[model samples]
Target: DNYNAINVDRTEQIPMDYTGVMGVPITFLHKYNPRQFEIVDGLNRYTVLDVAGLNDNAVKNHLHMTEIGGKSTYFRVLIKNRKVKK
Candidate 1:
């Protein structure tokens, strides 16, 4: 589910059956697929979107948002690097 577009040109042909989200970079890892996924890590600072289902074709990066919060600041890479707490 790695996106070559992350480094390569976003206009190049991508393989189907591949699945990964910019916001939810990892999804449906096993037989325990949940109907809904929340931002348990990075909530609203910056993430592309929520990936619910995997039946769709290869999804290109999209600007998606969610309404849930309370996720820890440690989830933030920069915050974790700075050792900040909330």
Candidate 2:
């Protein structure tokens, strides 16, 4: 898995078929359910490298972090839906 960021305005937009790590808006915490989802990590440069098993110098330009057209995104939480269909 690329472990790339998946930006969405609403939590409902998160794809249920996707079992890989996804970056969701922080607001998702309000409706978070332990049984349905697993908290992976926060979507940031440091955490992205950790989750990707990469060192600090492994990635340049912080590409692993949620960025769009060279611009960084807002705070996001990495998550995986346990109930996603296989």
Highest-scoring model, lDDT = 2
Model 2 misplacement above 4 A: 1-3, 58-64
**What lDDT does each candidate get?**
0.24, 0.72
Q: What is the lDDT of candidate 2?
A: 0.72
- For candidate 2, what is the total of clashing residue pairs? 0
lDDT (tens digit, per residue) of candidate 1 on 1-86: 22111111121222222233222222222311233222223223333232323213223433122212422221110001121122
What C-alpha lDDT, on a 0 to 100 scale, does residue 61 get in candidate 1?
A: 38
Task: Give the per-residue lDDT of model 2 (tens digit) for 40-66.
Answer: 887655564276665454366446465
**Alpha-carbon TM-score of each model against the true structure:** 0.16, 0.72
